[model samples]
Target: MDKFLKMTGFATSIISWYNINKRDLPWRQNASPYHVWISEIILQQTQVKQGLDYYNRFISLFPDVVSLANASQQDVLLAWQGLGYYSRARNLHAAAHQIVERYNGVMPDTYAELINLSGIGPYTAAAIASIAFGEPHAVVDGNVFRLLARCFSVELPIDTGEGKRFFTNLANELLDSTNPGDFNQAMMELGALVCTPANPDCAICPLRTMCNSYRLGNPFSFPVKSRKTTKRDRYFYYFVHESDKQLAITRREKGDIWQGLWELLLIESDKRLSENQIVRQLSESLNMAPLAVSHVVEMRHLLTHQNIFASLHKVKMPEKFNLVTFKDKIVVYTGRENLTDYPLPKLIEKLLAQYFDLPPKVL
Candidate 1:
C-alpha cells in the first residue's frame, strides 16, 4: 500500500505541474484526435517552434482525414516541403488513406489499433492512445526516458533494447490513470522546460526533492544513450534550365531524398566536381548543350545522417523541350508562374526565391 501510494503521488505531482506550466500549443489546445495526430507526427523529427507553422499549414490545407486522403500525394508532399523526413509525410498520407478505407474515417482509439497504421510507431501509438483516448498507455519518448532515468538515478543505457523495455515498464507504472493525458503531457513538459539536456535547472524543478540525480549533484548523468551518428557528405549539381519565361524540373522518385517532390535537373557525384565536368555532364545528359552555364552559390542541407553540399548551375536551354518524359512515373516539365504548385526541396526552393525572385509562401 505504501509503494502504491508513492507511485500515485509521483503521477499526481507531474499532473499538477503540467496543468499550470505547460506551453499553450495549438495541438494541445483542443486535444482533438486529428489535431494531436498531425501535431505529434510533425513534431517527431522537428521541434515545437519549427513545426508550428507547418502544422498550421497542414491543418489549413488538409483540415481532416478525408481531405488529406482525397488529395494527391504530390499535394501532400508540397505542403510538407520544408519539414524534411519526407517519409513521415508520405506515411501520414498513406495512413490517412488507410484510416478512411479500413477504419471508416475514424482514428483508431487504442494503441494496438493505432500501431497497425503505416507511420504510427510504438511511441506515436502510445502518445495518441494515451492523450487522445485517455488510455493510460505510457509514452516513452526521449524526454520521458531522460526524466525517468535521472529522477530514479538509473544508469541503464537508454539506447539499448533492454534499457528501453525497462523504462517503458517504469513509465507504465507511473501513469496516472485518472488523468493520463495531463500526466503524459506534464512529464514531457518537465523534460522540455526544466530537465533540459545541459545545465538542468534543479532549483525550480518540481520533482527535484525526490530526484536521485539531483541528490547526487549530477542531474545530467542519467539517461545514458549509445550510438553516435556519422554523417556522410553528398554532392548534388542542379541545373536550372530556363527558356523564355519557363523553368525545367524533374519529379524525384524511388529511393531518393525529397521523393515525389519536384526539383531542377539534378546530376549527383561522389566528390568535389569541377565546373567543366558539370558542364560536360549536363551537355551529355540533356542530349543538347546549354546555350549558357553560370555557376550559382553552393548550398548545404543537413539530414539526420547525411550532409548534402549542392551547387546550383543555371543553364539556359532553348525553348524546345518544354516537356520531357524521361521514363515511367517521372515527369519533367517547364513552369514559370506555377513552380510553387509542385513541392520542392528547401535548397531548390530557396534558390528559386533568391535567384528567380519568386515570392516566399505566405502563411
Candidate 2:
C-alpha cells in the first residue's frame, strides 16, 4: 500500500462521493436483514434492473424469514420466476427455513453465524453483518475486487485462489472500523458506478489520485482472470399442444434445469437434432395420436454456462383421435392467458412470446 493510500483516506474519499452519488436502490434504504439477504441473493450474477422487481415482490410477499419459511416451495419458485439461477431460490428457501427453525425467526447478526447458513457465502455474510448489524467486516465482492485491483494496480489474476486471498486481505485492510457499513457500500458503489470494467470514468473518480492503474493511464487491464470452463450447447424440442385454444404444459421435476416450473412438453437432445428427429421424439414421449403437425419454430437462447437451442413444434390436436393417454400422461392446458402465474425461465418466456405471437411484458 502507498503512504497516502491508506484505508482512512480511501474511506473518506469514497464515502463522501457515495453520500451524494449513490443510486437510491430500495435495498440501500432498507436495513432489515431479510431484505438485505434477499437483495444480495437476487443480485448475485444478475443486474440491478432485472433483480429490482423480484426484490420488491419477494419482500412484499415474504417480508421476513418466518414468512419465507412458511411459504411453499412452489410459491417461492413462482416469486422467483424469470430469475435464471434456480439454486439461489432453493438455497434462500432452505436458509429461511433454517433461520426460522433454529434461530427462532431472528437472523444471525454475525458474519460467522450467517456464513454457517447454507448458500450464504463470505460476501453475503459480510454484507449482512456490516449493513444489518454494523459489524466491521470487510465485504469483498466482484465490485470490490475491481476497485481494489485498479487502486493498487494488483497484478494477480482475480479468478485464481491467490488473487482472491490477496484482494480479501487488501479489502480487510481498507475497511473503515468506525463506519464499516458505509465504507463497504462506498467501495462497491465506486466500482459499480465509476471504476467499471469497461471504459472507467477515471476523471470523475474520487480515488484517482491514489489509484495506481489511473496513474499508469490503463485502468482496464488490472485484475486479470483466466477462463477455465467452456460453455456447452444444449438443444430442446418443445411441443406446444394447443387444444380448443388451451396450451398443454407440465412442471419439470426435481434435480433438473428449471425445476418445479411449468413448461411445454419437452425433448432435450445431447446435440442439435434435425427436424425429423425432433418430431419423432415429441410424438413418442407425449404419445400423441396420429395428427397433423404445423409450423416448426426454432429459437436460440444463451445462458451463462450453456447455449440453449429451442425448437418449438406446434401440433394441432386431432378432433377425434384417442385422448385418454395424452391427458393422463401429462397436464394439458387450453389457453396461455394466465401462464405468467407459473414459474418459468426467461428463455422459455422469450420462446412463449414468439410462439403465442404476443410481445414481451414486464412483470
Candidate 3:
C-alpha cells in the first residue's frame, strides 16, 4: 500500500508537470480523431520537430479522413515523400480506404478496432484510442520504455521479449486510470523532455525523488538494449534519360526501396557493375540502345539497416520514344514545370538538384 501511494504520487506529479510544460503542438488542439491519428503516425519513426511540418502539410492536403481516402496513391506518397519508410505511407493509404469503405469514413472508437486497421500497431492504436477517444490504454513507445526503465532501474534488455512484457505490464499497472489520456501524454512528454537517452536532466525531473536510477546515480544504466541490427550493403545504378523537354521516371512497383513512389530508372545489385555491364543491363531493361552512357556522379546513402552505394549515369536514348510505350509501367514528366509535383526519393531529389543547379531540400 505504501509503494502504491508513491506510484500514485509519481503519476500525479507527472500530470502537473506536463500540464505546465508540454509544447503547444497542433494535434493537441482538438479531439479530432483524424488529427490525432495523423500526428501519431507521422511521429512513429520521425522526430516531433521534423514531423510538425509534414503533419501540417498532410492535414492541409488531406484535411479529413474522406479527403485522404479519396486521394490517389501517388498524391499520398507525394505528401509523405522524403519522410522515408515508404511502407508507412502505403499502409496509411490502405487503412484510410479501409476506414472509408468499412465504417463510412468514421474512425473506430475502440482500441480493438483501431489495432485491426492497417499501419496501426499496439503503440499507435493505444495513442489514438487514449488521446482521441479517452480510452485507458497505456502507450509504450521508445520514450516510455526509456522513462519507465530508468524510474524503476530495470536492467532487462529492452529489445528482448521478456523485457518488453515486463515494461508493458508495468506501464499498464502504473498508468493513471482516471485521466488516462493526460497521464499517457505526461509520461511520454517527460521522457521526451527530461528523461532523454543521454544526459537526462535529473535535477529538474519531477520523478527525481522516487526514481530508482536517479538515487543510484546511474540513470543511463537502465533500459539496457544490447542487440544491434546488421546492415547490408546494396549498389544502385540509376540512369537519367531525357527526351526533349520531357524526362522519364518509373514507379517502384516491386517491394523495394521507394516503393509506390516515382524515381529514375534503376538497377539494383549486390556488386557494383562496370560501365559496359551497366550499358548492357540498361539496354536490356529499356529494350533499346543508348546513344551514350556517361558516369555523372556517385553517392553513399545510409538507411536504418542498409548502406546504399549508388552511381548515377546519363543515358541518351537513340530517339524520343512514345510516352505511351512506358505508360503502363512508368511515368513521363512533361517538363520542369511539373517535375516537383510528383514525389521523389531523397537520393533522386539530390540528383535533380545537381541537374538543375538548385539547392537540395530534405525532409
Candidate 4:
C-alpha cells in the first residue's frame, strides 16, 4: 500500500475503534477548552482512574480560569493534596493567573498561545489545541510514543531530543487533519487499551496487521529509552512535639521537596540517625530535654528522583515548657484537632493515620 493510503487506513481504524470503545469520561462529556486544559494537566503523571476524583473536585472548586486565579496558592495546594508532584499544581495556579490577565480569563485557542502558558508544554498544548480548538496538532504522550514506536519499529530512544522530534513529525504526518480531535484521542486510547507496554492485546489491535514490531514478534522492545533514573535516598526524622493539647507544625520552606506543605518538626540528616543521636539533636535544638522520647514508626516514601526514609517520633515536652521558645523553628502551634485544616505531604499524612490515629480526609 502507498504510505498515504496506509496512514489513512491507520487513522480510520483508530477513530472507528475509539468511537465505540472509548471510555465514557467526564472530560469527554464537555471538551471545552478550560475542561480539557484542567484534565490534561491533572493527567500528566496521573492515571485516568486516579485523576478522576481530583478532576471533579478541582473543577467544582475552581470551575474557570478566573476562579482559579483568584484563589490562594495554599487553597490550590490544599485541593491538590495527595496528588504528588506538587509543582504541577503550582504551575496550574500560575497559568490561571496568566490566562486571566492576558487572555481575559479565556483559555488560549492556538497551540502557540497555549504553550506559552506556565507548565503547558508541547504535549499538553497539542492536546488542548486539537481536542478543544479543532487545531491540527498531534499530541505525543507516553501512550502515543509507544504506539508509534512499535507500529513503525523505530529504534530511536524516546528519551532523546532527536527521538522526540522524529515521533512528533511522524504523528503529525499520520494525523487526520479533518478530525484531529478524535484522531489524537483515538491514538492515545489505542495505546492505553490495546498497544500497552506489556502483554499487548495484538489480536484486537487496529494496526496489528501493519505493525512492524508485531510482525517481528518483539512489540515490547520498540519504545526504547536510553536513560535510567537513579533515585537518591535521604533520611527524615520527624519529631511530633505536643504541649498542652497543641501540636507543633512547620511549613516546609522553599527550595526543598514538599514545599508549602505542613509537617511535624523535622530534623533531616544525610544518614539515618540512632535514637540517642535523635534525642541529642532534639535537646540541643529545643534547648530542653524531652520528657519522654518514644519511637513511633518508620516509612519509606518514593518520589520520581528521591527515596525518603522517614522516621516519626513522639517527643513529650515538659509540663511547663513553653512552645513559644521555639517560635523560630516551629511555624505554627495548632490544636491537635485542627491539623486537618493545613495541607500535609503524603508521608506526614500517612504517619498521622498509622501512628497518630488521625485519619486523612477524603479529598
TM-score to true structure, per model? 0.92, 0.92, 0.93, 0.95
Model 2 score (lDDT): 0.82
- In order, the Cα lDDT scores of the candidates are 0.83, 0.82, 0.85, 0.88
Give the alpha carbon lDDT tens digit for every residue of 290-313 in model 2: 366655678888777788888777
Q: Which residue runs does candidate 4 get wrong by more than 4 Å? A: 1-6, 324-330
Best by lDDT: 4
Q: Please give the range of 10 consecutive residues that has the lowest summed lDDT in model 1.
A: 322-331
lDDT of 3 at 302: 94
Where does candidate 2 clash, by residue pair? 245-334, 246-334, 246-335
Candidate 1 ranges with C-alpha deviation above 4 Å = 1-7, 318-331, 357-363
Candidate closer to the true structure by TM-score (higher is better), 2 or 4:
4
**Comparison by lDDT, 1 against 3, better one:** 3
lDDT of 3 at 28: 94
Q: Which lDDT tens digits does candidate 4 get at residues 1-363?
A: 246345668888899999999999999999999999999889999989999999999999999999999999999999999898888898999999999999899888999999999999999999999999899999999999999999988899999999999999999989999999999999989988999887799999988888888799999787999989998989999888776777888887778877888888888888989889999998888887888899898999999899899999988876856565442655578885787688889888898787656565631
Q: Candidate 1 local accuracy as lDDT?
A: 0.83
Backbone clash numbers for all candidates listed: 0, 3, 0, 0
lDDT of model number 4: 0.88
How much does each candidate deviate from the true structure in C-alpha RMSD?
A: 2.6, 2.6, 2.5, 2.1
Ranking by lDDT: 4, 3, 1, 2
